[model samples]
Target chain A: MTKFNFELTKEIELLRLVTVGSVDDGKSTLIGRLLVDTKGAFEDQLMAVRKKKGTVKVSSAAEIDLAMLTDGLSAEREQGITIDVAYRYFATPKRKFIMADCPGHEQYTRNMVTGSSTANAAIILIDARHGVLAQTKRHTHILGLLGIPHLIVAVNKMDLVDHDQATYEKIREEMKEYCAKQGVRDLICIPMSALTGDMVSVRGDNMDWYKGDTLLETLESMSVLDDLDEKPFRMPVQLLNRPQTADLPDYRGFMGTIASGTVKVGDELVVKPSGKISTVKEIVTFDGNLQEAFAPQSITIILNDEIDISRGDMLMHVGQEDSDSKFLTANVCWIGDEPLETRKKYLIKHAASEVKAMVSEVNFKTDIHTLAQDEADELAMNEIGRVTFKLQQPLNYDKYADNRTTGSFIVIDSFTNNTVGAGMIV
Target chain B: MSEHKLTQLKALEAESIHIIREVVAEFRNPVMLYSVGKDSSVLVHLARKAFYPAPFPFSLLHVDTGYKFKEMYDFRDAFCEEIGADLIVRKNEDAINKGMNPKEFGVARCCQALKTTGLLDALEEGGYDAAFGGARRDEEHSRAKERVFSMRDEFGQWDPKNQRPELWNIYNGRIHDGESVRVFPISNWTEMDIWSYIREEKIEIVPLYFAKERPMIERGNMLIPYYEENKDQLLEGEVPKMIMSRFRTLGCSPCTGAVRSDATNMDEIVIEAAAARRSERETRIIDHGSNSMEDKKKEGYF
Candidate 1:
């Protein structure tokens, strides 16, 4: 279809997602095909893809090379793999989508973590012939650790298996059993071919045996995001906006995005680490003072009384229980070349605060393929292990499952200033 | 600025404002790159809103190419004056002394000598630890993978292959002494989103965006405005005609191209953009080379 009159409002829902799989699992092709068939691509973009040189052909149509879609995804061919998470956007009348095309190589686990942190759902592509490969299990484990709300197992290359129902069932049952063991609660499995455009953007007639919805239909129907107001109030102050302007001579507003839950006027909250109590006086913005503000919305908070607080301090509900901790045992995915050795100091960046931290012990490393826990003394590059950290000071945080934003932190090498690892508090 | 459920546009506005505040809080010497374009205008407005009642905490750096349209300079002057922002216009004095122009030295060398070198010179003189850029991912191909807080090395080289990873909304703004981070808060917004937000917010833009009758010449599918400053370049057979035209994107006057459109306002531009088949960079002369922007960016061209 050529361009026609299309005017849209910003009121539509947006679904943020991440796509992960092993190398050559047709992840790029799947996204490319999905966007192309749904008319998400512009004419010039399609032309550029078609004219792309030195493409490895994966399409039978012979006109456009689908794999070439990964070219500009990062344009950084680091050892022939994507180096960063490339965010792609597409919209339907039903909803808007923002997806991160995460790399699959083992060493780039940090890239995968970055993509999944903000995502509500994950599309894990699994080759039908190679059911539940080691990389597939690794990605699933990472997804589970990140507390992603929904998961979709795209059993690709159904055409290669002649769209066999029994084959799909076997793979689905195996994955379900594994996920159950890994504590993954929500999942949906579908069989399709990204190369042949089956059950991706449209339902193929050959896959009539599978009665489930198409991938797009599933995404459109699922409420992938959580209502932030239902949880406890948490907003780490990014900065203080004391415009101190002419209209209001004395004005002090704490600027931040509510990590979860809501804050209303006169709500009782405590400043973390400082432990000072205050009532929310106003929710300030450029337009006007808001009656209430919730998660993901950036606004300024004004308290009734002057409290001693700064950017690093967090504002949280007083009712949240027993959150102070000096020692953290978290699941960490090491992303640096330097091995994570015990007693080595690193900076823990949590929310807006940073603390001096050192690994106390390496409990065990999970062999992602076998789902076996093996004792390890240290974690090298691309290794995932349960590690204990002793912080120089107490940190107020919730379990990763409770709130994705407040429960996670990053490990920065103190000397190199490199992000070496990503940890989710257990 | 409407107070309601977080709409897409409102979300974008909040995100941009947050980034600006982060720059102010974290960096000692920070500056906003104001190119006198729509994106930079939106960026400066956000900066003002981000620090309401107080003046902008940091100064603004405009790497004046001197080849820019006259209207852009006027808009830059008035906008900065109205907002009371500290605006510093840095021009490459060496190139001006050497009499460098597109007609003499071609688009690449001229842009390099004027914009790239001029921006570096400004940063060196100002010692800015952080610079806020209005680059959107949907605007260019390679920018799709850029971090919200992208880092440039001590020599101002962008290592696209070996860069830091950005996770969640939490950006790593940490850097060394010589290193600097280029933060893009509106990285998620698309071209249509920009125009639509402009209409909703009633943002005042340059008059060159509106179609008007002006003396113009066609050069290889692009319409070039014939300025009085360049009257000497007209050939004996070349007679410029007054045509209705407007620019989808603005840049150096000689390199920027205008389109044949009757879109005279934000609403009309939005409507025209909905049906237009051309990419935004099609009119840019520097990008005519084989994907040259990415290569230039790696060498510290923003």
Candidate 2:
């Protein structure tokens, strides 16, 4: 009855991870193993999976169809393929994890991008028997573009490869090379059989030569709070909290979730687009007033002097504000079925600001298999490429590598309001 | 002086606050669907924080089935008044006028007419362009693939297959005049997380969540409470018993089931929830089938 130590688990950090691989790379099996081994999967959920008719055996030792655990849609079950992203949750005493189960089909690259967008780390599965495939490179390239801080290459299906040390090493070498080319800075390779539970959660004795930590260990120990705290201050004003109450008639507060950096009381801040400067009078929350607040904390800020800071305006550290520009160069992943037409107006939403924008030019598109830049006039659905955009107004932003929150944006079709593209400031 | 990083709970709170703020900022008229459940209690708490020191700009909509437990209505009225927010209660007057009930019509049709149709009717009447719900991805299978900003057609029909791809934290709230958006601020939260946060924040919930010796009748592995709302649904041979039970989920008295447990306090409930094998949805008879929830959602059931 006391198996779950709830008292010992307090104030645990949240880690967001995503799974990416080709369609048959055992991504679902790996996730199913993590949930089951950690006791995160409930009995009813497992029973439902076990009760499915014609369940495919993913691992020899596993009694349940692990891949069926995450395929939620009836159509997905019928086709035996994932079409969209499914989010899963689990927890250990030390941390809470939100795993984004992304599909690997070429047509569903949009789903993978959506899943990887907020992930702090990504686990890219590489079949040990197939070595590195085109889907691996494509996912790696997309992950690199999304600026996922950590990459764990799980060399799965080792049992099919006879658990040979040479095969794992070969795939690891090729992945390391390709990941490096894709600008993956932090990478770790592990050899495991997701089906057989070898080196996934508890290291099964099948792979004695593998010396690295298990997949669960690697995820649990990943440092999620990157240099976000050290980055320059950026907070997009989401709302102007003007509480004209009887007791508090003069309250004019700015509200937002600090995109990055830390802010303290009496700190000097400049409101963008107006260049108005003011000092922080107080940081307010429902609990109480705070002297200091940092990135990802939603709080209200009161200024020493009155300023016309409206929604969509950025409050930044003095001399650290990104200059506004009407033209932007960036890499984009087209997600809409409708091809990207140059000179067609689209709504570009970045942070809290939305403005009319048009694709000025398509610099080039990258081939998924060869990683080669080819000339293309239009970016089709699920295509990754570099494109230039001309905005109707000046936008203040930073490079995607420097600040993901402020640098990333989504392209929306003006007529349909569908998210057509995901762009990163270069 | 603390570290700059936020705990998991705090981070979730911050995220939820941000989303609530965004909904208020973008849409002209937005409403939060408060079901008087644990999730709705947390959502109301977050909404209170989202616009502290100022009156909430939107109203809290409660779709009443006229079959909820009496304790739920009492809690809902008192809780809304305590927070000083506007509350709008809507009912399927047409269905009620026709004498529609679960036992006679069935759970699926009853839900469709009472909850889904009632919700859509209220939303259209209020001209609300965006409505927030307390749906979590971990609760059901189909919900795991739902977008934070789920778009619905002019008639409030959801096309799950053609949903717009959501990326990053940038949400697309733009929609045509007739269309509306259903935003889930706590989409990523799990059931355990909900209980843990409830205990941490000390949020007041309905007393139904606490175990008590209430009159109940056994119905096919379900512990159905013997109340005025469900008195007529009893079979010939069934008998009511005074059992120590509590609800895992809340709905109409006839559709929801109670689990036998001794967990009366928040701490005990958290421990029990952590160790329990069955999911919370299993107790809600409306979600018995594999595709019922999905089908209901497509018909605009929040």
Candidate 3:
């Protein structure tokens, strides 16, 4: 096959994942083992780390701190704690993976949210000795909240417990019960020793009692494409690609990124807010003509005839028809220093559109540990709460559970010009 | 194209284009910071595509340190002419004339006075409300925490501890007067992705990136390039050695190091970069100083 053909096939088979776990739970070790055993680590990097191991004043007792392979910062090396989301790319013959190694500290929840926001799957690590801690519960709840379809509970440090089946089963049962309570349906549990390379990319003799697909095999087999493109068509106009100069006075085109679904030429579409109907004339990009443009693609669309359209306008399928726009009831993860105050006007940016929104009411706050709902007037830092928002204008959106691209938004602090919180429309 | 993969790249591209458009729509006066590097080249390319057939809405801002490779300036001028984009060049000639060499004030201080101050002064003078940068999150730890619409205070300071939560593709570029926002459209892209895109797009870059015969000296593992008049600052232990070398990253000539390589073309460079373990910044003597990038960033260094 040609190089282009190989790359096309490889791109189709790639899996993007974000790993989350509390401090020192062997998340980095798992990634390192996966990279090392798979021969993903370059020869020079391995040798350099080995030669400079204990000799470096920054590192701890050498022995190839596997975390060094991913964590690029010198401060991160000295602290032995991941502060920001570090992305690493590696490929197996079966599949390519781009893993976002997010910081596990509770304080860096924003970083974790950013990392896992674009992930198709999540690997939530749990230490066998500690069982399911507060941070583990937090991560699981956040994953569920983020609408991550696939969850892998990697019960790391199993070797410390002699790779006992009972311990793994107990932790798995607890996680399963908690996830079920939080409405997380798709979850898989595996026991492994990240430090010793057990049940990571390949099966190990240490886990003879466990029979399932290896982590690598599971990663390869998981379906990523089906989950993203199955949603409805939603396009947010980004710009108007028409030059109103003398050369192209009559030329007009609505340019935007398609948030979801496929749009083809001759398809009937409705421009939201203005409620103007138009037929797709052409889909244009920097490259040659595209017959049709699908979800997530940024392209300029020319209509058969000109209709009034501007930025922040949504284009949807006319036949399918969307539900009546109304006030949004959403589960919000408050990230600001100050607690969320009800009845405050803030800038709410959803997808490609931004509008003035006010918090109509506070529904309740979720307890990260207990997964219980409580009536609260305000939401503090790292608090998850359900709130009602009244927008100045109705926004065209889907339910967060159905479509993450259209249903999510961030609340900006008007005075400080800071992004204070994140919300997912229910 | 397959239905699935097309959807993925489309989504990423759409978001990026939306961001570029927002930078144009929201800011009163916005300019793009072009470094003549792959990242900035891709940024300019995206901008052209974002608002095609309508010459880029914003001007290109280049902070010339006067110590850059001659090839970079040549490429910059040629690219600007070809794209029909307005170019604004800023330099700290006053400081340079005052003997403010990198050797005197160290790499961090020199960069602070020359590049960062030059950029700030240009922004202030141009009355730009927003500046589009080509910084990617995958480049460094601090950058990974950066927002697509990064807000800079009145003094142009970045507070790492407190940052806005960026959700979905929606960016909030709203800021007060006298405070400008630094917009990064390609924050999600990695080093490999930049190279891959450059290769795929056939974007033209400086020839200094490819290996060629150049006068240089050996200083610690890095090949220090020798320029006129700056040879007196060489340490006693460092030896002057002539070798075929190229710059992995473009910066002030004194601080940036050259690597010995035969990868004179894009394809060979890509292969060599892929196999190389060390980061592009590792060879630079500027970053070798104690948390230099972070310290500079804290002091409003771009």
Taken over the whole model, the C-alpha lDDT of each candidate is 0.82, 0.88, 0.78
Per-residue C-alpha lDDT of model 1 across residues A27-122, encoded as one tens digit per residue: 988988877765556655566677445554423323566767556533555457787788787777667788888888877777888788878899
Model 3, range A226-310, lDDT digits (tens) per residue?
5455566888787777688898787787877777788889999998878889899888777755888776777778898778888
lDDT tens readout by residue for model 2, A143-206: 9899999999999999998999999888888888887777789999999998889898889888
Give the number of the best model, judged by lDDT. Answer: 2
Clash count in backbone of candidate 2 = 0
| Top-scoring candidate (TM-score) | 2
Cα shift from native, residue A375, model 2 (Å): 3.6
lDDT of 3 by residue, B144-202 (tens): 55678877888887765555555656677878888888998987665655676666668
- The predictions' CA RMSDs to the true structure, in order, are 3.3, 2.5, 3.6
**Clashing pairs for predicted structure model 2, backbone only:** none
Report the C-alpha displacement of residue A286, candidate 2, in angstroms.
0.5
The deviation in Å at residue B211 for candidate 3 is: 3.0
Computed on C-alphas against the true complex, the DockQ of each candidate is 0.49, 0.72, 0.41
Point out the worst 10-residue segment of candidate 1 chain A by lDDT: A53-62
Indicate the residue-level lDDT of A148 in model 3: 86
Which residue runs of candidate 2 sit more than 4 Å off their true CA positions?
A1-7, A51-61, B228-230
Instruction: Give candidate 3 regions above 4 Å deviation.
Output: A1-14, A31-62, A68-98, A202-205, A227-230, B7-15, B226-244
